[model samples]
Target: MGNTYRRVLLKLSGEALMGDLSYGIDPAVVDAICAEIKDVVNTGVEVAVVVGGGNIFRGIKGAAAGMDRATADYIGMIATVMNAMTLQDSLERKGVQTRVLTAIEMQEVAEPYIRRRAIRHLEKGRVVIFGAGSGNPFFTTDTTAALRAAEISAEVVFKATKVDGIYDADPKVNPDARRFQTLTYSYALEKDLRVMDGTAIALCKDNNIPIMVFNLAVEGNIRRALMGEPIGTLVGGSCGIS
Candidate 1:
């Protein structure tokens, strides 16, 4: 397959980094993912990544458990930063040029998030990893991905998840759930498909950035998605649900 998009934002859930473990990142898994990223970079596609902190912590869950909402979110943001560092290290070890840019401004560990700098890094063939969730408490890494994708003029958002694509219902719970090859933003929002947070989906819709949700668990899926191999569901624009 040929590369259909020049630049793309990859959204990875932290839980995917856990691999077969119950918590924390798996070294082998991170290395494997970095290898895929290396392949994608070698193909001349500019890639920016936004990783979630769900494996380490969930802000909403913490808030529900009696922590202050803002504080919980801030904690979650830090977790994302940790994940970003781990990913950056793994990529660098694979001999792939990578940079970890954080919203929280921890200069000693990472560079602060700057739109121009990030785009420049991409132009220089460096993978830019955005961390710390917009540097705000209420927002999620998903929103960060959408915002960064727009600012960087990315062609699409590759949402890497455990499942292969968007389903009419939870596939794990319902064996008969149907997967959609393509879907409209309005339909997803109207049906509450949960492909992404409403805010994140709205941002992508407003910016006309198509989102491709695919399973990260499958080998070579990242490279396939980036190369437009049609491995998952495409959402946004006039693509009708199926």
Candidate 2:
């Protein structure tokens, strides 16, 4: 718990912000996550969050139909901005210093995605939330998360999920699916593990940033992950899964 990660990229799925509600943003869930972030920020851990847009807009649903791919993706990016604004407001209301940086610029509300600016903000103990999903199409928030992690030079990418860790199969669907405490990148690939998409995994592996997939739905899991605890599936190069 002592300085294992000076900086971390926490990836939260849009679904995580849904909380007990049905759609859009849930203030309770956002506040809970911010509380966890504040706990680690007090520990001097620099936090950069990459948030998803599914809670408000699912681009895939539109792209799957006759919708133009770029247009759908643009809508998805806008959704991320809404989520960022919600989180930013909640964190600020909690007395936590926060910044919202978007890939697609919306200067009236937040700063543009400038790596140096982001690092500077982090140095000043401001939690940075990255929105807008890489400002392009044909890319999921997962891919954006990897890209930002590498850019921010985060030691680890914590992918907050519904499950505590990776399993050999869908544990929810398959009761016998074994949960792996750790896994090797090769095994994850050789076995076709669905922990992450191939593109996201490849980026993390290529950049040597270990990905910790843990269940954020569980109380305090985010803090545990930031503390570098062995609470999730750790995927990285040579280190395998842990």
Candidate 3:
């Protein structure tokens, strides 16, 4: 079988699972993602996921109201746990084996984050979902995705975004903006693209892991991107798409 990625770290924003709705989890949308993930698994790729909690709780929202950033971050982490549980339920109900590992020590609820254990689970064909966003303040889940992808030596960091790929400008705001089929990290930064936060980009660069930005809402996009099809912008060391 042709495989572009043997192992991948899927960075799913909570908002993606919300579909077109304004907030909270959307069952149909989440199911679609689970289906896509399962299809990828059938292709012999080991998947690890890092899901963000922006749909339920964004730390910045609390910080804007003078709440302590650290406290707000912890709240965000807990929200991620909720999302993880929901995802685990969705996947298992569909007959897939899954595990939710949290960064915080919640012995009764989920497994504590351990690099080797997580990797072993992936090697055994189990879907490992990582939540809780680094278990600390002053960091975003995007950074957590990069760190985890590197820790497990994932071939690519798949960022499931709302847009099809990284654009020179926000396609929604700018009708004339163009989507890049491939990109270099330096060019993305030089052009001031905002596909990911600065810290996340830094982590990927430091680890030499490429980031593939694609719209998760787009049907079959995830599987197509995983097979190395031309579906999104690939950015990082030696993307080989110049």
Return the top candidate by lDDT: 1
Distance from true location, Cα of 191 in model 1, Å? 0.4
Ranking by TM-score: 1, 2, 3
- Candidate 3 structure, TM-score to reference: 0.96
For candidate 3, the 10 contiguous residues with the lowest summed lDDT are 233-242
**CA shift of 202, model 2, Å:** 0.6
TM-score of 1: 0.98
Q: Model 3 over residues 1-242: C-alpha lDDT tens digits?
A: 39888999999997887888899999988888888888888888999999999899999899998999999999999998888888888888887789999999898989999999999999999899998989988899999999999899998999999888988777889999888887877777666688788888878888888999988877998899888887878898665334
Distance (Å) between predicted and true CA of 190, model 1? 0.4
lDDT of all predictions, in order shown?
Answer: 0.94, 0.88, 0.88
* Candidate 2 lDDT: 0.88
Backbone clashes per model, in order?
Answer: 0, 7, 0
lDDT of 1 by residue, 97-116 (tens): 99999999999999999999
Better of 2 and 3 by lDDT: 2
Better of 1 and 2 by TM-score: 1
From the highest lDDT down, the ranking of the candidates is 1, 2, 3
Residue pairs in collision within model 3: none
| Model 1 regions more than 4 Å off | none
